[model samples]
Target: MSDRVELELGDLQGGILSAYGKRGFPFGRFLLFHVNHPAAGRRFLEGLRPLVTAALRWPEDVPKPAATLNLAFTFWGLVALEVPTRTLRSMPEAFIDGMAARAAILGDDVGRNLMHHWDPVWQVAPGRPRVHILVMLNAAADREGRPVPELEQLTRLVLALAGQSEGGVVLMEGHAGADPRFQELAALFAENPDGTRTPLPTEHFGFVDAIGDPVFDGQYPGRQEWAKCIGQGAVDGQGNWRPLRTGEFILGWPDEGQEVATMGLPLDFSRNGTFFAYRKLHQDVAAWDTWVAARAAELARLWALPSLEAATATLKAKMAGRWEDGTPLVRAPDWESWQAARDRLATASRAERLAFLTAFTFADDPDGRCCPKTAHTRRANPRDMLDPWYRDPDPRARRGSILNDRRRILRRGLPYGHRDDPSGEHGIVLLAYCADLSRQFEFVQQQWMGYGLDFDAGNDMCPIVGAHGPDAKFVIPAPREGQPPFIATRLPHFVSTRGGDYFFQPSMTALRMIAQGMVDPT
Candidate 1:
């Protein structure tokens, strides 16, 4: 019998299963709306339902759609839609409180990341309307990264619906620093002289992004499923790879805990649904470039590196736990190895390249010699580093990676604004989806990224996204004998929160119930 878990594709939202930017739809626009009248809100949803894309597998015979749309509702949105009181109270407290309310716990209340410093749309001033609904539209981009005509048409339609005087839904403004209307997102790309664009996975910081996203059952099809899950999914003590339980990401399914958690009353209302943490994170490229340059100069002298360029590259790789091109440090522990790996990848097949990038273990580097324990990628996903019995002589007594399976989150979203503008409105619209917000998303953010206890790094936060100040530092351990560890000091905040919120992305069934006013919970 096959152990594969079949997902309810038609019932799930497309955004949950697929990262549209990686699937050829790279340009995106996010619009926030405030629902004033429940009746009008339902009417708007009913009209918009047809445009919402489902998580159905695309047929190989047909061309992919030029644009895709998805929807998510805040807790306030459910209230605005007049959902039953019982259902409202049954929601997870973290979602009920929302991202802004939990800012301190998330380490977002300090410095530029404070809620007051966020975009005007996220600032809930006295008598101002709260963001209720979020409509995400993704469209295909041209070779030059410009949006296709279809995106404008779809935008017009959505604007028309929100602009109707009696529609009772008002569009929220001041989200994008460049436009002050809707947040525009686009993946960074390289243009070819032949009028074709090659999407570069790198973010504004010039490092490749989204390299090690979690893989779970039913995420891929057939043989590709297990193949893709290698090193990206749960691992056993015997060093075997397998997909994580579907419930880790989808609702009403068994998770890594081997049981389904309590859902909102009336199973259908919450089945196949999941929670999302929408975050607008602004990257300070100027600060990042300046800091890395100065640090690299000092590192060149300390480490006796060849040149400033090599020192800068090594410095970035040390902090990121991978080379800028997405090669894991475990696979290429030094500059020479990184260069060799790059050469191999230059002629490797796509599948072969992926394995080189992700198929590696941190068990050997327990002391973090190859990759710093506090490196951004290492902190975010420790892999086997968190295993309690990893150091045990008896391999059978070890717990490989059970501890991290529950904390994995599906990352989706794309970079926004121009990459050339160092001080301009530029950042990533980070979207994280998981069955439980506190367990998966919040835990990773608070414990892994914000704190340093798990990695034995003593309050030293992740250098990439962690809140930093003059006292902040990241230690890079030297593997060779007689070489002292290099400490990069006086770290600056590389990334900061601009605006964000918690949202519940419902299944198609739940959406229908909401639109039809059949969400009864007695």
Candidate 2:
């Protein structure tokens, strides 16, 4: 709202803005398509703009209105659309080449290390296009564990609309589920023998998942504080640090770079749009459990703990930088402290809640004493940890890096697979949105997550999620000085890249441009 940061929510796609906010819609489906008939696809793409949600339409309330269903239209599918080839070339090369190419470019440390390297569905032939467009349908789920009938109706409505464009055909469809192997873990985290479920969200990993997500402006009025903590807020040493510049996530506006994004060949076609990387990540629950279970007992004996289970929980928190319950280690530091924070949060003031979760920086604890430098959260954001260092070496510049601005990505998507199917095909469907894949998403995946020089932990991948191989180890500093560090070694691949593709989520305006055959580069 300030004169300096004018974000046009109305101009941006709602899905690109706040579509996944407010704990996200309970039930959703992913539809993948390959453009078969370009003309038809154009019509389809154009028709979709009218149906797409706008950021301005986000409900002001906690829970969205009943029967509320939203759609985000993005493309790998666009390549298959009837647009001219030159237009495709004009787009980001990563978007044109897709995630497989991007992954290959990211090298062995990141992409090749992915479990999906062996996935049958993920064996995408080099240069052979896979998924083209990603149609995300998010709807509220009923207590009966059924997709709301209204959502089904909404699906039919969208399908009918898609019928208007012959630009593409269905390539595949993916839904959220947990493998059968996930049952025990799900029960441990969230389940009852009565066979019923609670609304309390828990990922297949059985940890309180999906915490401390960055909230952009236009999504919520109170997210300014949340944004700043993530490197989006104030760059200057004055004023309230707000959420990252809107352009950092959404295209068209100024980004954390303080520059307007030059999207694709035709600027208008790319404006208000963002790029999304769709990843079907398969979680190896059994492997992750085996590793942790072995360590938890050793830790219990070392700490003289009464229960191995509690020790396991602590190790998990240390691995993820948060307890399975979503309490952050940076704030809680230990089980007792984590619980205290959790209890307080039940009635904590707004300031208390924000500070409890969003507040905290690595500046003071640069040593990874409290929250290990190699923790998943630290790798993903780095907070003030990566403050720009090179230009002037001024204390502030050395602490915060504008490069962090270019690296921040907006995460979306939900878990796929059934909860009780242990060894079942349960995993998370991740949507990483950013203006540039190589700079933002790929950089984080490679530099920060896979390689640890950024954390001063040299060559150490993320202990929990990174591509850890045999003899791999995660060092959790001892709680008190002089105490030895707890090392969890021989970590198995907990999550594998099952299947993925990159697509462009264009602005509604761009969708219309594509549909109307108006994508002239000149």
Candidate 3:
């Protein structure tokens, strides 16, 4: 399946990955630490942070002193301890209790919060005892070529805290996305002190060693320009935020008002912060591929095209409201409109552009006629095209109208795992940047992915990544200019949301404070 890519070593967490082979539990955590320098990161993290410790914060208005941190956590939440990194063999009774306690905290959400929601089919998977620790550093280093950070040292700390023995197993994981810095780090790690890198597999479809970074190069100055208007209304001299100019909903400037500092807790209060969500979703590759093949057939029939390209064109046209080549179907249903919206979304005020896209036209009716409500892009941001009938009754109405959208997220994750590995399932780690996780990322998942109701109402889940019934059957209603909507039926599941969790990415200032052990939660 196109979406069911291969899994690679680069994609799998370095520690305890092999345990999955026997369905054995491998507990782990992915951590991103804000470090003042590589030296500081290593020295401070030589031992695991205790769970009883207070949350830290950076000081106000202070950017990180050139270091930052983020962490990914995946453990059974059983046999809990207050200390970090407990090993299986050496795990103390206290550590086991800590794990158990943490697991209990997570289970509390099982029947209540969508945040706690997991596939009923696979709750047993995580229920198995395991821990996967993944960490990401998203800040510029004090200087490159600092003695490479030791993965083994960090692992040992975690094992010690968990009270597990050395043979208990642990892996230090790293990713090389499209980013140059990450590439540098991966290159360093993939090689030994003698300077030889791991051999690239001829047929390896797992994660590649190519590094990808999350920091945007600021080639697009719009982010800086838009920062000024983030809190203030997007308006002219009259001060009325114009619908023609900006989107209906505006988040305004990020720094406006007496907002809580990034490090309001035990950390410095001066740095910026980013949130993260992590998951260790296992893919049943064989099953996913089978579903993809079956779904492709349905797509072929729906678009009346024999090739994937033609079907993709129809799919893209309906979802983007245009084609990949950039044609707006509303203006020229058959042409591409990549040019119109691309630069505009990156440059124009959010509201100004959103209004234009959401402006309904008689030429393309969305009432189950043109774009399906569940299309990926459509579900992410409905562009005010959701059926009015369903709008009022939206279970998540507190998030407000989707027409004038806000809380746009910037995606920077890279594809992981193997591209052709029959043994493993692989895809992008799927990272995003949003002003607020609750307002933006969480909203999209809950309303669109979980609810699966969009402009068309009671339609199939999103064509990509969205879920539907246990059978995983899906369909995309056809979009003929004047003809009745043609339902492309019986599509199979391709991109399954294996599993993930939310995280808070602290700025450099926060990292320094965290190292100093004085972070305060905002």
Candidate 4:
């Protein structure tokens, strides 16, 4: 094993390592900008530089800020800022082409997900200004978990600075249909009798989300960090878990492939930097609920389940590879087991609960008995199932997660709009961060989620987030002896792509270089 890489937290952006929602900032707004004057745009970036949050860990004595800010730029945005030609040319092709241009490959070109059907902001019309930069603002909720007044104040301040008469940047419009300025993001919350709100882990589809994010090296402090990597990071044949290589996520470091991939012209320009795929996924809650209800009814009779409630819960768990409460199906295969696990979790310590939720492997459930091979979670990560020697009869011969370690991505962002209003525009703002776009983010989106050949389910898509048509189907293998598999046919399009784009969130050093126009290819 190589020496562990030490991350320079101060040089990296906070959004790369931290999910702001979990850090007390559950409410956020995404603002887009178009730069018309290169020099003036540089001045705008220089003024906002100090406000951008770094990944440095907060001290125990110090309180976190009320809000956090981060910035990213598209390829055209770099050009608008007059970035050196050499540095611009060095960027990956997938990013330079942008998300809309690669819609077909990402399975976003069909039906409502097509480029034309996306938000007007993402569409590059003849007379409209093209999107160049993305500004993310995450604000802390009040004691009652309600939106604070400071959020709006901070948003207005930033908008005014960007749209100032002398500034070169223009705030883009037409997000989320009615909201022409910026898109608002908030997590789902439960209301109490006292009028207090508590954020929930469930998404619009009712499945517990934001679980099992990849743990890379230097993400956490101390020896305990290794313990947190179990089932969440790379695993050896002996089932020993450890944080994945730093280069797998951050630039200018050795990746799982044992090579430091070529970045832009200067090393400082790319070090600690990462690429982001900003996706706005609109979920059709009415369609999802109606489908789940009908499927649960049929499954109740076919599986001889006790009640409609049990069948409903079981069918959902199978589809998501976890119960609605975030319990992995591999850990709690049935309704009774799920209930028991939930009961245990209610009293377990914080550490114990974290272990229970993430510590599980697909080694024992090879045949998709407990969790379906094509289930959303299983297909998304695969864990040790993709190991070269996974099928060896002797468990000792199985190598662990060698192929999967390279494809991991850091997931950020939160749910947007109200979940109760199903017909209203609502879903998740998914942010995926990785060092390599094509190798990591694009590959998973295209191969794993879009196609099912790796799982031996040819032409089938991921039941939950896959881009398959209405004719697509999902297979849930029988869990016990003498029980037949339940096949869901003619699946509906539950999720649609609203809009998105690819961007490079540069390191603090790179930001300074861009702000001062100091980039030199020579």
Candidate 5:
């Protein structure tokens, strides 16, 4: 019995496969809420369902609709609403204990990672329960207008629904996304001539963001990119060439192991649902500029480069594993080659650019010379780069992209705050989706981004987003074997987490059960 018929595309929400894809919106916010009344909450949740975006098929000619809204519940939130005890017990321990429970496993510092930080607006102080549900609203913007109207209407609708019900409380959580004071900060990562609808623009760091996301079941209609994006998901005598299985990301489907995932005992309730990690990352622009300027100059002198700016840019690319424009080092190993790729990409169509941008892999550049093994991109995605990092036991697992296949995350986030303010509130609001938070999202954060054991560079960390206290180093050996290696140490923090939590986006069927009070223990 295939789960597809049981959990059809229409059963899921659009946010699962849409973010950063063709359906991606320019603006969005996560309105975190809590249940004030359990009895009334059941009624309220059912009412809110009408507003949730369904897995509707999008056509090529018609632009995918904007002003999308989705709902995600936390373990505490569900408990607050009096979920069936038997059902809760069936859930994985990881989901019921909440994201904080997995903090230790994720190797996060209690204070630094804010594994326990609550929303400051609530003044709940430390060690208190945070909000339960997250109302994710997404929309696009034009030069003259942002998507504030759609978001405002949707927010008001949620409040109105709660007003009549005795169960839920609309949280007044203050987020930078809705506040006017951070308007400049809001548009920080946005394109020029603000509020205009643009497709996945670069972040304040002055580089393109969100590329090479995993390709899944072609949910977004009239799109061929998703199928082609996998870059040969399989392997043969020639090389690997196949897309990852859809089940690896979406629940109730066969994963890379060729087995369907089990979402607790009642497969009907959790089949089409997935997990999410919402992070508010604050970028330190001033620190990055100051540190990079000095380091690039030093590199120029050591490598006998042309100028400080040139060397600095190259050094930045080395750290990120891609050129500022999003070209991978494997495709263009040197500054000169990268510049040529950049120029050619400029004239290509958007479709051509996106395909070209993510087409390359580490199969050819196994050595760190082309793209450093510890580089941010290589560490984060790896993509047929590592030599059996996970425990496979079987010798046959020594090769291919199976090691990092399940680790892929569907990145669906936008930049927040404006670059206008050097010290102002600005950075990316990262929203990543995966079937297993422990294996995918948290794994990348701990093993790949924060540390460097997988790359064989010792404890060396990702230069761009690694949280290694105040002092850290990013070492790059000279492109030529004999030249002196360039070492950039004492990398002041370029990014930090403000506050965030994990969420469980349930299927529409599960939502109906909760609303009708049909969730009693089986």
Candidate 6:
């Protein structure tokens, strides 16, 4: 028995999953620094790599390379940073700074130029991390903003520890696209011709999405549990954490198991390995502006509102169960409530909590009025209102068949993209994590987003953002006991599905092993 167990264990170790779950910060920046020297990339990787990897700890017996590292900011990403806060505090302050200083140390030859840029596809409110450093702050507040002064303070702290550089550049671009400033620097490095230079747009459309999410269990124990299954159990039964044959999220797989490989190096073969499929979706902001402006009166009238802005805000407040600032409508349904709804919701049981969220105007109009049935939220997770409030067609199958482990991806990250709207080219860069994308994420998109068969009999799509053809119609639910259902009206598409793909977030141990060219096919 002992010998058999030993053989089964073989070179396999755990901890990869746990390490990722422990770190809980939002990955504020997806930086891509352009280095002129051949060794620049290596230098940058060396410095940032350690900070990211050193903080990560894996389970025992997992066969991983010494160099691979992973850092996640959100739930999925945070799961990979297994180090305790105490350990992080013990690390040298210099090493905790941004990628620049660390890059300078590893590849001293890379030039120092701070190129600041912004993404056209993203229209985030001003006051967030234009850049990120290793210190903590108060961005966790519901309506809080990340100030620049705070950023400067964090930078000075890094400089004090990491030494000096040639100066730095700031760059921003479409969420995944290149920052204009970064692009300019790149052009300078490559010496591009005058007309050949691609100009950066100040505004655009598309979602600014983050990529690669780690599987989240809980905190410490979650971390430990994950570590124990580095390459064994699926990250969770859901299958979101199932490693690609190449062992992206785990280890102990052979090279051929990978979907792709080159030069003896196992390439990422797992489909949807990248968390968020990032694209700088182009948009005609100017034209969109004109169209909205011209039809402002018409839109306001259709929504029965005083202004288009009010209508938009009204719609948002209803669907999200909160305002754009993250205030929950349930607690502050009156918009003048003293106690915040978000706080209250945070303390309730998972079931009650999900129900309380229905207070959003869309689910239950604050004015006891027109939000109506078949609304977005109602269609997606009808819960008590649609599922419980009313009896199902087949009462026996109601409870069981409805939720039936319907694939449901846990919402784990922020949505990024441009603020401006361009005709029919605006949509969220939906980022979700699941043990199984086929079941959870895809189920919601197919059953809920694509069809209205999940909840009410109304054929309404998400009014504000849902896409229906030129002649799309909304079937409003009847009010009270005897009201007849009404067809609101035929609406044009406001949101369009531009493009999207999924990806996996590997555990640090798994990454290190892959980087080092180690594969255990068995």
Which candidate model has the greater lDDT, 2 or 3? 2
Candidate 2 regions exceeding 4 Å error are 1-6, 19-24, 59-76, 105-123, 126-129, 158-168, 171-198, 215-240, 388-399
Ranking by TM-score: 1, 4, 5, 2, 3, 6
Assess the local accuracy of residue 253 in candidate 4 as a C-alpha lDDT between 0 and 100.
Answer: 80
Using alpha carbons, what is the TM-score of model 6? 0.44
Error of 4 at 14 (Å): 1.0
RMSD to truth, every model: 1.5, 4.7, 13.6, 1.5, 4.1, 16.2
Candidate 3: list runs displaced more than 4 Å: 1-43, 46-134, 137-271, 280-309, 315-332, 335-365, 368-370, 386-407, 470-478, 481-484, 520-522
lDDT, candidate 1, equals 0.88
Q: How many residue pairs clash in each candidate at the backbone level?
A: 0, 41, 129, 0, 15, 63
User: How much is the lDDT of residue 132 in candidate 5?
Assistant: 75
lDDT of 6 by residue, 1-522 (tens): 001111122122222222211122211222222222213322332344333433223344332332222322221111122323332332223223322232222221122111132143222235532221111121111112222243334334333322322323122234433333211101001123552322121113221111112222221232443442232222221122221222222222322123221211122212112222222122334533453444444434654555567544444444433444334443453333413554675677854553343222222342223443455544444333333423444434333222422332333322233344233332233335433334444455555655555545444455544445455555543333465543444454444333222333333443333324332322
The lDDT ranking, best first, is: 1, 4, 5, 2, 3, 6
In angstroms, give how far residue 186 of model 1 lies from its true place.
Answer: 0.8
Every candidate's lDDT: 0.88, 0.64, 0.35, 0.86, 0.70, 0.32
Which digits, one per residue and each the tens of the lDDT, describe model 1 over residues 1-522?
138887888899997877887888888999999999998898888888999988887764234788988899999999999989888888899999999889888998898888787888998668988999999999988756688988888888888887773759988888755777899998888888988887778799898889898888888776566898888988866677888888998988899888986567678888899998999999988889999999999999998988898899999999999999999998888888889989999999999999989887788888899998889999888888788888887878867777798899999999998767745688899999999999899999999999889989888899889998779999999858899999999999989999989999999999999988998776
> What shift in Å separates residue 244 of candidate 3 from its native position after superposition?
15
Tell me model 3's lDDT, rounded to 2 decimals: 0.35
lDDT per residue, candidate 5, 1-522, as tens digits? 112222365688877766623464667765667777877777777888887886665653334665777888887777777777777777666677665566565544533455343335322346654677777777766554466477667767877886786435656454544462121113332345654544446788888777767775544343453445545243321344555667767778778788887765477667788888777777888888888888888888888877776787798899999888888888887778888888898899987887678876676665588888889888878876664422344535546656688788888777776666544577887778888787788889888887788887888778988876655787786788888777788987677676666777888887777667776454
TM agreement with the true structure for every prediction: 0.97, 0.85, 0.50, 0.97, 0.88, 0.44
Q: Which of 3 and 4 is ahead in TM-score?
A: 4
Q: Once model 3 is optimally superposed onto the true structure by TM-score, how far is the C-alpha of residue 66 displaced, in angstroms?
A: 15
What is the Cα-based TM-score of model 2?
0.85
Q: How many backbone clashes does candidate 3 have?
A: 129
**Regarding TM-score, does 2 or 3 come out ahead?**
2
Model 1 residue 132 lDDT score: 98
Worst 10 residues of 6 by lDDT: 182-191
